[model samples]
Target: MKKKRPSLQDVANQVGVTKMTISRYLRDTSQVSTALRSKIAIALDKLGYIPNRAPEILSNATSKAIGVLLPSLTNQVFAEVLRGIESVTDSHGYQTMLAHYGYSSEREEFRLASLLSYNIDGLILSERLHTERTLKMIEVAGIPVVEIMDSSSPCIDLAVGFNNHDAAYQITKEILKSGHSKPVYLGARHDERTIIRLQGYEQAMREFGLEPRNICTDRPSSYSLGCELLKEALRRYPDTDSIFCTNDDIAIGAAFECQRQKLRIPNDMAIAGFHGHDIGQSMEPKLTSVLTPREEIGKVAAQRLLARLRGETVTPKILDLGFTLLYGDSI
Candidate 1:
């Protein structure tokens, strides 16, 4: 037989106090004397007693926890966002429950259902699109929700992000202005954001009286994928003068490929990437790219969710933090 877990009564017995006193102390220490509070704390620690929060959640209907959903855990972008969100949640005595959905709507729905079952007070989602069932679940939960990373789409409740389309458009326009007329749009993952960036590139190319050339894949974005996309771009568009990548991973990959082929940066091929990753900045010919406010978006999203939870009205509902263009020597 397994040893039994310590309970409230066990702690009360160890502290020589009534079980009700122990329960009251656990709930609120203000009602209990300081001496007794110290004693109870000691006893609880000694017994290794763990309080079950299920009952408390059922009683109060608030778990003091926030649920955050991301498409990828290994992505450094999401990691920065998580750091920003936790900075706010940790200080406010709120716990964060994280879930990864692998960029799949069905998986997101499944993960969201599991999170909702825990009675989380609020939710922060990285993706704007959701399954119908997922939408229904959120409606029923009636909790504050924040959709992040893209302000172009309509949100369910609240949103905090920059415009992906405009950022891509601006970057592409810059590349064109620099006299790289035969620029190729290189993309991987084929996700919503990737597609939006493509649209921006196409718009810029059209405005310049040039046709958009693209080499894309549904494969997840990676440095290796970038190399592959670069090879394909060069094969199809031999005259490709510049490469505007969907993200830094691809941009860096393409840059490395150019170096391997003994191609000179900006002379043989000009390369640009989105998201000003540290590695991209550290490259020999630093990558020219769009620097999105990822961490700030996360911090602001958490703040808005918390404000809503605190019964404070969040104005405008949609927040556009904007982006910056990093003019590295690559482009």
Candidate 2:
């Protein structure tokens, strides 16, 4: 037979305390004397007792937990966002439950349903668009939710992000102003953000009386993909004077390929990337890119959620932290 799981009563019995005392101690350490607290702590460790939170959640009590959903786990951008969120959640004694949905609205709906079952106090979502069922679940749960990374979309409750379209448009205008008229947009993943960035690029190109050119792929963004896209761009649009990549991963990769082909930066071709990563700055001809306030967005999103949870009024349902253009040698 399988060994039985330890219970609160087992812990109480081992610590020579009533179950109510154990429950009080679990709820708040201040309720128990220091000596008893130490005994209970040791008993909990020894018996491997896990306090079931289902009872507390079923009673409509706060779970003291926040659910965070990300589209990608390997992306460093989300990693930085997670770091910023944890910095705030950790100090406030709240736990974070993370789920990855791989940029699928359907997968996001599934992951969110699982998280809601835990009765989390609030939610932090990476994407603005959600499935209808996901929206219904959030409405019924009636919990605070903050969507990050794009402010242009209609949010369920609150949003924290910079304007993606404007950021791309501004950068594209800068490229044109610098005399790179025939710039091509290199996009990957074809995600919502990527498509928005492409649209921004197209808008700028059209405004300048130049046709927009795009060399895109459905594959996830990577350094190798960047190299391949650059080769294909040169082959297809041989007269292309500049390359504007969706993100630094592709930009840096294209830069390396340029070097391999004996092309001079900005002379033979100008390149710009989005999401100012440290690696971009470290490149020989530092990459000119749009610097997103990713960490700040995460920190502010967590702050807003926590504020709402505390019954504090959070003004401006949509918060645009904004973006900056990093003027480096690559552009």
Candidate 3:
């Protein structure tokens, strides 16, 4: 009732050759004569044969793949970063397998362990924090690994990203310089990057002799969270002159909420966001924010890992790409 799946032996039989010869031809075309190779190719096409790599992978003990772990799949920030990684990997004829841990270290551990079981050649991780078992697994794997998006001390191999603290501090100081002294910091997600940015904001506020007010939540950042954070900030710090958000999602949401409340942007409450998302610029008043080099960090991290894989030396393992302060009407 059903057609049988073609096997390597079927292709070999079709070409009047032994399975071993066909196997050698599949592994390396040079091993077979040109005429025989053409015959094998024709037979494979005729049989609709597919070469399975599982056996080869088992024998070679290398998957010829890169495992990439990201915190969020829907975020454009990570999409851009993935693009940068693929730009390098695709050229090198390497395949990338992606997994999302949803910003959870425990889930990240499980996903990473599963990837390692596949014997991937390398790994690119967006999150810095890892469980002890995750750390041990990586150490045992002893492959080229890279940590992207945020720099951390005692990294596995390479750390590539901008300094979140400095970026937040510089941007906050700019808002203060713009005459918004009573600014509050709003954040969500409570990721390592969020905490670092909050620290920077707090440091800037203290340095300016102003008390820092932070209204934050552990929930993942979103447009709705932005609106809610602003509402809470307004409720508690009624005299808040400005708000520095952890990311553009919240900042843009705050802008929309301000419009609904008939609050004049900047004149009524200055707002700034980080990550420099395109939507932030589309707002009526535009968003003032910090633009971190997310894609560039991904590209550099990939290049570094590839270099190590190729037996090339990688100098200065930790790379600080830095960030830009986008001056706009919101601040």
- Local distance difference test, per candidate? 0.92, 0.93, 0.89
For residues 260-320, write the lDDT of model 1, one tens digit per residue.
9898999889999998999999998999999998899889999999999999999888899
Which stretches of model 3 miss by more than 4 angstroms?
Answer: 1-5, 11-50
Q: Any idea what lDDT model 2 has?
A: 0.93
Residue 104 of candidate 1: its Cα lDDT? 92
Residue pairs in collision within model 1: none
| Candidate 1, backbone clash total | 0
Q: How would you encode candidate 2's per-residue C-alpha lDDT over 1-331 as one tens digit per residue? A: 9778998889989989899999999989999999999999999999888778888889989998999999999988999999889899999988899999988899999999999999999999998777889999999999999999998988899999999999999999999999998999999987889999999999999999999999999898899899999999999999998999999999999998998999999889999999999999998899999999989988999999999999999989999999999999986
- The model with the greater lDDT, 1 or 3, is 1
Scored against the true structure, residue 183 in model 2 reaches a CA lDDT of 97
Best by TM-score: 1
Flag the better candidate by TM-score, 2 or 3. Answer: 2
Pick the winner on TM-score between candidates 1 and 2: 1
